[model samples]
Target: MAHEPAVIAALDVARPLVVDLGYGARPDTTVEMAGRLRRVAPDLEMVGLEIDPARVVDPRDGVRFAVGGFEMAGLRPRVVRAFNVLRQYDETEVDAAWSRLRAALSPGGVIVEGTCDEIGRRCTWVLLDVAGPVSLTLCWAPEHSERPSDLAERLPKALIHRNVPGEKIHDLLTLADQCWDIAAPLAPYGPRVRWRHAQDLLRERGVDCVVTRRRMSDNVLTVPWEAVAP
Candidate 1:
């Protein structure tokens, strides 16, 4: 929800809406996101979309529920957060799914789709605008893992299987572990320090990435798709 402002500003919309796709049977998460987003975009609206009309929760807290899927219920959204919605689909269907979702976005809107472990200790998401996927973001709870490569188990479905040897994702994860090992000394200070050192090592080794100092504090690393695309 913190990214709401940027999305709204980019779209030049006065009231930006966030679509929580495939939110399952519970509307709790949608309601929560709406509350948090309102803090930033006071007029932000939240809509929960589900394929199963029966799964829709009763609307409350300014979060409305609707029956829909990749079609997006005919509403153009500024950001569509489709977390864990594609894990069951074959990887071959990813591109088409992205296309459907992208078609429903307002100009400058984005689709943040990804998979995350239970409790969100580990996660990977792709940020896509109407053009295509822009970047991949890996996020983790600092104390949950020792090396950044440990996030391999949580990669989004699009690249989870590509983590095997001979693949770019494999090489990236391999380098991440190697870099973390080399930055072990920084661990004595804190995971944040060690993580930053590990990220620096990736840059030093020419691994393409977008370094966000503030985001690094949240245990996140956003890398360009070309760097680890399979």
Candidate 2:
């Protein structure tokens, strides 16, 4: 499940992990998020902010349900994971949302915004900091491999619309696919090896890079914002 403890372990923890901009359609994910955080960071508190106040039920210790937007509810947190929360917004509005969320972060905070297929066969998200965009990560298991750019079809609201010609996101995605193609021989080494080789290739080719032993195991290749930014 997206909000499970194992999944939450991959996510960084903060004092108050807030799931800003949840849905009226379901609060189940928020509930799971709280449970998972308590497992990973025992002292962590979670707050779910829903613009639709009706969705927020009775609150308890370590978890507060509030009515707020993607801009944040005047709470500074270390981690904010907003999944499928911005799928409907216009691209132009994405920046404002990011600005508001980043502004509300506790200095070193990170915001992960993305969408996953109903079953999570394929998922992608962007990581941002106070300095602005950082990287776009497309996580997919290739049992159903199409072109890597198929994910371009599912870019976040900010980038989905920007996947056209002359876009940075477009260029970086293409580069990712190209890296995959060039690193095909490494596939014999295992997907993880091939991926690491591919990422190394990116850095060698001077794509601003960020890769760690921990991140690599997670199947994430975090590149510079300019490489895949909108």
Candidate 3:
């Protein structure tokens, strides 16, 4: 959620519209998103899209609803948040869905696709542009996490089943776990402190860790797609 501002800024649209793809039966998620986004972009609009016709709700202030899937209702959204939607499809279908959704993006748009635990403590998502996926972001509550690699269970579907010994994602998580162990001494201060040290270790080992000072304390890490691509 911290990166939402960056997602909005990248839109470059005066009255940007963000689509909550497959926003389930409940309209609460879409409504909350609009309220939060309006804090940054007052003119922002939110549209909730669901495959189930019954899930569509009446249009409300700065928010609307439509029945559609990957090929959305002919609306070129500046940002698409497809949380946990792809998990229901086979991994092989991901590319096709991404292509279809990417085609629906307006200029400078992006698709945030991924999954999170029930309580929303941990999350992993890919940031996709017209060219394809550019980065993978992992976020969690540092104090509640066991290790950096523990996020593996929350990885997006595209990479979740590919966490084998020789896979790139596996390699990254293995190294991250090792670094977390080595930084155990810093744990007394708090997990965030230890995580910062772990990140430094990752950088030292040539892992492409992208950290921003403003969000560093958020316990989030963004790495280039190539760094952990399967």
Candidate 4:
């Protein structure tokens, strides 16, 4: 959230409210996210929601817990982090879920929805606003990913089933693997460096990627949603 310009802009509003939709059986992740976001907007309101009413807990660490699902507990938040919430639902239900979540957002609000591996070595997410999905991002620990396409399993529900042949995502991943192989000589410099070189090669080949100068702990590739839309 702190790194993305659009996300930062959305949080730079008056009385910003952020929601951690479907924060799971524990509130640990919600509490941690509250602290991280507080650095960006200290006065921001944070809420953790769960569909199971029995799972709701008392407010703690500046985060309020409540019972909610894709409806978002009827609270329109400026930003919503809905990780791993849609994985359990059928792919056919993704659109309706997204519609519900989008409707629950405040004006100019954004949603970061995605899934990650159990150990979080691989992850993928989509950035969306009132205008709809803007970009798709793939993040993974370089050492854990033999090729960028290996993160395909972690793609958001909207794109997970679309990773088959002839799809834009399949094409992107194929090109990424090709780039990674072509950048093999950089392996001695470490997988992180090799991954960045692969991304650079991708850009040279006409892929529009969000290349960042700052070094990140994970290898990240973000491209406009249209680049990988099914």
- TM-score, candidate 1, is 0.92
lDDT against the true structure, each candidate: 0.83, 0.69, 0.85, 0.90
Determine which window of 10 residues in candidate 4 has minimal summed lDDT.
1-10
Model 3, position 89: C-alpha lDDT score = 87
* Angstrom error at residue 86, model 2: 2.1
What is the C-alpha lDDT profile of model 4 across 1-230, one tens digit per residue? 55777888889987799999988878998999889888888899999999998889999998999988888878999999999999999999988888888999999999999998877799899999987899999999987889898998888999898898999999999999999999999999998888889999999999999888788888889999999987
- Report how far residue 187 has shifted in candidate 2, in Å: 3.1
Q: Tens-digit lDDT track for model 2 on 1-230?
A: 23322234434554545554564466666667677666666667677788876778777555667888866777787777787888878877888888888888775667777877765567788777777776767777665545467776667887788887798877777887788789899787777677777778878877776665553333555555567665
Predicted structure with the largest lDDT when compared to the true one: 4
lDDT of 1 by residue, 66-145 (tens): 99899999989988889889999999999999999999998889888998886778888988889988788888888888
The C-alpha stretches of model 3 lying farther than 4 A from their native spots are 2-6, 215-217
- Candidate 1 stretches greater than 4 Å from native: 1-12, 215-217
Candidate that would win on TM-score:
4
Q: Write down the TM-score for model 4.
A: 0.96
TM-score of 3: 0.93
| Of 1 and 4, the candidate ranking higher by TM-score | 4
* Better structure of 2 and 3 per lDDT: 3
Decide which is better by lDDT, 1 or 2: 1
Q: Between the candidate structures 3 and 4, which one is better when assessed by lDDT?
A: 4
Error of 3 at 14 (Å): 0.3
